[model samples]
Target: MSTLLLSQDQVKELFTMKDIVEICEKTFQGFGEGTVINPTKVNLDLGETAAFPPYKGFMNAMPAYIGWTDIAGIKWAGGNLGERKRLGLPYVTSLIMLIDPKVGNFIAVMDGAFITNMRTGAQTAVALKYIFNNGSSEKKPIKLGLYGAGMQGHTQTLAISELFDIEEVRVYDVMKAAAEKYKKDMKDVVKGEIVVCDTPKEAAKGDAIVCVTQSKDKFLLDKWVKPGTVIFPMGSYQECDDAMLMNADKIIVDHIGQCLHRGALAELSEQGKITEDDIFGTIGELAAGKLSVGDYSDGKIVCIPIGTGAMDIAVASIAYKKAKEKGIGGTYSFV
Candidate 1:
């Protein structure tokens, strides 16, 4: 048996934004057409930590199988903000495994931290392409508001900068220093103006807003957002308030079924604020041109992503293929 091993750096060297974009486009097309088998994510809760006051969360392991391709895999990742802070590390730690569909044998193991960030960013970009009228003649460039300055925020900003002709980006975070640092780091890559905002309300004034903060309580308000703006909520669990969701003209998700069950949208449904019927459709449906964004004169459009595993696998599969073609990763045989 032969196995391929790829390190995080190796995987990074092999994959690019363009590659991830193509992978996401294909995955979204398949998902829209009902040609993929992506199961719901499994959540594992971690008990209370005495070290950090009132800090509790869960670990998520998502398994998926993609049709029209010979790839199957699972993304095993865990996050605990309190414990991570104690250890001086980020909240989430992730890894991915690619399995041979025929024998169900492990073909490769790689770091999923990069895969998760990149795929999530790409998914948001795909949604933006379908949600906004890019070709329309508008004088001012599209404005962007971003919440959080963490990995998700950084990567999503990079992806959005690559895909959209953004004019300005306003960022807000509880930690003012972190937000400033994020702006400094992103200055090299982002062409638009990066302004740090004191509050979510200030950031929400942009034409488009992206929320990636991990806030148990609500942070966004409906009154701050302008009509015709687009919102992308990346914080999975409880990120936005009922008012924001209720006021949205169209609610788009990566997968309505999964989002309705355990994601940010689920929390809203549990409170009886919104139901499955409230959602307009999935991002895939929009990408495939099957569902339209419809009239936007009423209010803004919101795209909530639950984070799909098929995207991670598709990206990993592409990375593995490139590694083989370019003679990147070392191969070994066992008897």
Candidate 2:
């Protein structure tokens, strides 16, 4: 059997945010319609203070075979925050393996980081497209407030900025240097001014707020948000406080069932701030036009996405196909 190997840079050039958005929208629709089979991701965690704790982390392998499409793959990723810092690199590293269902052979191996970021940003943008009224004059050029300046934050800003007619972007991070650097990096990519904010509160007052921090503790307050604003928290599991969830007029998640298990929703639900009935709907239902978000004038709306491996598999499948068509990746024979 011949296997294809793709580099990170090669995959990066082939898949754009727009492409990932389309894939995610379709995948989510399939998921909502009960057409997709995605099992719970398996997690194997290494203790906090292991000998090589920095290199020791959980490995999550998500396996799925889409019925609608002739694609099957698994996304394998591991997190090592301390090792990343020590090596001056990103915290999470991933790889995706695409397999041919008919032959049961390894088709390709590609970088999963790019897929992770793009799908995540695309999913968030899809949620916004469904939740917010695009035609309403009152909502044009949505004001965006952003926290955190890492990969997720940067790509999230890029994806949302392209989908919405954003008027301005207010950014904040604990590290002022990182925030400034992010602002500088996004200067040409964004049409609006990327102004650095002095505090998190300052960044949370716009029409839309996105928190992408890695903080384990809550950094945002519910009282700071105004009515008609939508908040997308993409940070750690417990990035937002209970007050934020309590004050929300509607709470939507990418996957309601999964969010209830591991994301911010789980944290809030555990605190008794919200219940199953409190969930308005999943982004997929809204994207498929099965549901509508009426007037959000009463309070804020929150959409939380816990990363999904299906997304990685989908994006990687696309990349793998393209690489083969263009004769990009080197081919090897495994006997």
Candidate 3:
């Protein structure tokens, strides 16, 4: 038995933003139509795991099976909150395994960190399609405000820029050097000017806001963002405040059960600040036009899509297919 092994760089080489976006769109439609079987993630407190000593982190297992695509997989990731700055390592690292359900064979082993970053960003773009430009109609050029200049931020920028026609990308990070580096690295490549912002609020001023921070506390003020701005609060809602979630004109979640368990709504659910009724609908519903949200071109909206397993599986399937065509990655006998 042979399983293809893909590194982070190989995954990056195999994945294109446009293709990833298409995969996400198709997978989301499948989700709405009940053609997929992706359930809520199972989170483990890594601190409680039997390590040499107590650790300070979390690990999660996300499993899914897309019957229509005949794809089954699980993605597992673990990381500490401040490990990146303190340990000089990635905050979150992950791996995924694809299986042929009929034979129960481990088909491939690939780095999930890159896939997670890209697919999460692609999911945000999918939500944006329905929120900002429903029916795929072109709207005015967008001015994008971005928070956090980490790897996830880079993926978010790359994914959104590839899919949307943005005029400017104003980025903010507590570390000035990081934001500067993001600008320096991305300015030449993207169509828009990459501007470094002095504050998170500065970065939050635009037609759309994307918060990619890994911070645990809420740093964003509700007043900072403009009315009718589409926001993607996707980093476990760590960067969001109560007002941002409470005041949004519309809210979409990737999955309601998943959200309630390990999503932006978890905290809100605890505080009695929100209920399922407050949610607009899942992104799947919006993508399938099952919801009756009209003229979303001018509304303050937010989507909280906790990264789902099926999204990763669908995208990895695409990448695997592409790699087969392009002869990418490495393979060796596992049996």
Estimate candidate 1's alpha-carbon lDDT, on a 0 to 1 scale.
0.79
List runs of model 1 lying over 4 Å from the truth.
Answer: 48-57, 134-140, 331-335
Worst 10 residues of 2 by lDDT: 133-142
- 1 versus 2: better lDDT goes to: 1
Best-matching candidate per lDDT: 3
- Give candidate 3 misplaced runs (Cα > 4 Å): 48-53, 82-87, 137-140, 296-299, 330-335
Residue-level lDDT for 19 in candidate 3: 84
lDDT of 2: 0.77
Candidate 2 TM-score, true structure as reference: 0.91
Q: List the residue pairs that clash in candidate 3.
A: none
lDDT of 2 at 19: 81
Q: TM-score for each prediction?
A: 0.91, 0.91, 0.90
- Cα lDDT tens digits, model 3, 1-335, are 88888899999997678788888888888888888889888988765334634566788899999766787999998667544548788877899989888998888889998888788888887877777777474534677888888887787777776567778998999899999999888775457688898977778877778888766678878888777788877776447788888988888888888887555667888777888889889888878778745654545787787889999988887777788789998998878
**C-alpha RMSD of each candidate structure in angstroms:** 2.9, 2.7, 2.7
- Look at candidate 2 and tell me the lDDT of residue 222: 86
Tens-digit lDDT track for model 1 on 1-335?
A: 67788888999998777678668878888888887678888777664323434556466788777765668898888677676779887777788888889888788788888888888878887777777753232323567889998888888877766666768889999999989999998987667789999977888867778888777667888888889888887775557777788878889889776787765677778877888889989877876669888668568998887788889888888788888889888766543
lDDT of each model, Cα atoms only? 0.79, 0.77, 0.80
Sorting all predicted structures by lDDT, with the top scorer first, yields: 3, 1, 2
